[model samples]
Target: MSSPLFTSVHVGGRQATHRVVMAPMTRARSTQPGDVPNAMNARYYSQRASAALIVTEATQVSPQGKGYSFTPGIYSPEQIAGWRLVTEAVHAEGGRIFAQLWHVGRMSHADFHNGDLPVAPSAVAFEGKIWKVDPATGKGEMVDCPTPRALDRDEIRDIVSDFRRAARNAIDAGFDGVEIHGANGYLVDQFLRTTSNVRTDEYGGSRENRLRFLKELVCEVAAEVGANRTAIRLAPFLTARGMACPDILPTILEAVEFLEAQQVAYVHLVEADWDDAPQFTEEFRRQVRARFRGTIIVAGNYDVERANWVLQHGYADLVAFGRPFVANPDLPARLAQGLPIADFDPATLFGGQDHGYTDYSPMQQAA
Candidate 1:
């Protein structure tokens, strides 16, 4: 018998060839001035088309949603055309792809906002940093994030609209579906935690109220794109960047129930990967499985054995590999044939040309 990881599965209303997914990573290699995807971006994604599904790097929904320099966007005509290149390339190679709609919220620098503060659910400061490139030297560096202003009620509504438009744009650009970037302590994650969100209106004060933003955002996106085609990524166990909340687990359980109600395609759970990170209790996994009937994809420091463990035990339907897929484009075939995997160059991981991106050869070429 073959490993269950090699079997086909239904995800986001499409049939994926296998259970190995390509988790989205920030490459910061979009074209300058317009922050648009380019032919090089298309080639990079096409190379990894062997994954069951490819979630493109977090593409900002709006200009203000941008946090890192050179990340692509989906809100403009140029960006949509640029992403079309990527979707076409991936499809031509017989692969499926989804665009990750994102808004950085307070995880941004004023350099992105023209001296204005980044907006969040509350006017709070966290010990967080964002990646930025110095214009003079053109080198990426991590910089401190200043305190951000709270969004007015109307601005919050506007952001929800931004997500909706981005989803529509993704479909227009020929993606199979769209995944909301709700994990990784970004805008959506910020609203879910008490330490980051201190709003006093209907948007906050209670867990239900805190969840209102996410509920609204999901509902609107699902309405624009069919619920069967809409998906979300959530990090229930994340506590980094001043985001530790005592009530977060129960709150995430509540969010899962709402997602089930909405009938969204899948829930991508990002487990803590660092050595000292808290354990994602199997008990919690059981709880989530009971609540949501949709597909569940898990990503962390997963090896072949661990990936099979989750699938065999029914904890997840698919496993996503980030760095592994970067160095090994034909990751599925390599795993199936037991070929040697290559190591990626961390220095060229971000904001670079094809040297460490599309230049990584498949096993046949390497051999």
Candidate 2:
């Protein structure tokens, strides 16, 4: 039998031609000053339109939501106009695209907020680096994140409104839909984990409390845009960014139930792929499948065979390839033909020019 990847699937009330999804990847190439998407970004995504769905890189919902340098935003009118170009480009190529709205929370440095500390559910700080451009040198570098100021009850509500507005802005900018980035070690993820959130308020302490922020944000976004056009990304067992919680698996399972009840189009799970990363067991997969009967999109370091295997096993409805699509603009076509692909230059990945961004020729052009 032929691979199910090529089969049409209904998503967000639209029929996507294939089950190959382009995962939201952080390619920090947007224009600076305003953090707006540009023609280069439009070309970059449109080139990979063969994927059934393309989730844009994590876009800041507001200036305060920004964590990295050069990442795009959806808050300003200029930003919206910029994104419209990207959406139009992808649509012209007959592709479906969703904006991945983001709020980095404490995963940010003070420089972005005029030396003000970033806000989170708790004051805890993760032991990691965040992208920032040096004020003196104007060169981008990863800097240590300080202990963020915890958000008060009223502030939390404001952030929720920000997410809802971002969803509306995405629709106005001509996106097919929007996906709330509740995964990784960002804002929503911070609130979900016990280690990061230790407040005794209604949003902290117990598991249900930890899940409150995510639930509220999702509800706002889904209400702004129908659940059919809303989705979420979750990393259940991620530990790289100090996300290893003893009860994280069950917490995510419960979150999935909430998302399922909301009728979200899909839940994108970011699997462990780095060296010695914690394993997402088949048992866990089964549990997720049982709870979330809606579409499941799994992303790891999956190749063609692995992607097809998961789809066949009822583990995932779609597989997302990140780095592969960087060098192989026509990744779906290459995968369909079992063709070889080139590796992307690692150095040119973040805050770069057109060299590694869109210069990767298709197979025919390279030949």
Candidate 3:
């Protein structure tokens, strides 16, 4: 019998031929000035169309949602047209893709905001940094993040509207569905932790209050795009970027319950994959499985052996490979046939031309 990893699965009411998914990664190669996707981006995605599901890089929903330089946006007409090329390219290859809507919140630098402070749930200091480019040198580097201002009640509502609008734009651009970026110490993750969000208002303090922003954002996006087409990514064990919260696990369970109620498509769980990172308990996995009946995507440092292990045990419906997909476009086929997986060039991973992007060929061409 074949490995369970090769088995077909249903995700968001759509049939995926296999269980290997391409996790979203920040490439920072969008067209400058307008921060739009382009033909090169389309080619890069099309080359990796063999994956069961492709979650595009974290795309900012609005200008205020951007953090790093050169990341793509979905709020403008040109951006929508640019993304259309990507969707068309992937669809032409018979592959499914979802746009990951993102908001960086306080994880931003003032250079992108015209000297204004990045907004968050509270003005708390975040020991975080963002990738920025020096205009004079035209090279990107990690820069420290300054303390951000708290978002007003009305401003919070506006951000939620931005997410809903972004979802609509994704569909208009021919995307199969949309996934909200709620992990990796971004805007939504900031609101979920007490260390980052200490507000006494309706959006902070208690676990329920802290979940209010996520609930509203998810509800609004699902309303614009059907709940069956809406998805979210969450990280429960993430402790970096000043985001360690004692009550986070229970809070995430509550959020999972709400997602089940909304009938959302899937929940993408990002495990802490760094060296010495905390382990994701199997008990928590069982709890989440009991709460949500939809698809569960688990992403971390996973290889073929680990991927099949999770599938055989029913811990996840799909496994997402991040760096592996970068170097091996035909990752599913390579794994299926036991072909050699190539190593990616770290220097050219982001903000570059096709050297390390579309230049990576399939096994036939490589051989």
* TM-scores for all predictions: 0.98, 0.98, 0.99
Stretches of model 3 off by over 4 angstroms after superposition = none
Displacement of the residue 107 alpha carbon in candidate 2, Å: 0.9
Q: What is the clash count of model 2?
A: 0
Worst 10 residues of 1 by lDDT: 10-19
- Model 2 accuracy (lDDT, Cα): 0.90
RMSD of candidate 3 to the true fold? 0.9
Better of 1 and 3 by lDDT: 3
Q: lDDT per residue, candidate 1, 1-367, as tens digits?
A: 6798989998645687789999999999999889999999999999999899999999999999999999999999999999999999999998899999999999999999898999898888788988899999999999999899999999999999999999999999999899998988899999999989888899888999999999998999999988887999999999888889888999999999999999888899999999899899999999999998878999998888899888998989999999899899999899877789899999988898999999999999998
**Residues 1-367, candidate 3, lDDT per residue (tens digit)?**
6788999998634687789999999999999889999999999999998889999999999999999999999999999999999999999998889999999999999999999999999999969988898999998899999999999999999999999999999999999899999999999999999989999999999999999999999999999989988999999999999998998999999999999999898999999999998899999999998898888999999998999988888889999999999999999999999999999999988798989999998999999
Give the true-structure RMSD of model 2.
1.1
Task: Name every residue pair that clashes in candidate 3.
Answer: none
Question: For residue 202, what is the lDDT in candidate 2?
Answer: 93
Which regions of candidate 2 are displaced past 4 Å?
none
Task: Give candidate 1's whole-model lDDT.
Answer: 0.92
* Model 2 pairs whose backbones collide: none
lDDT agreement with native, every candidate: 0.92, 0.90, 0.94
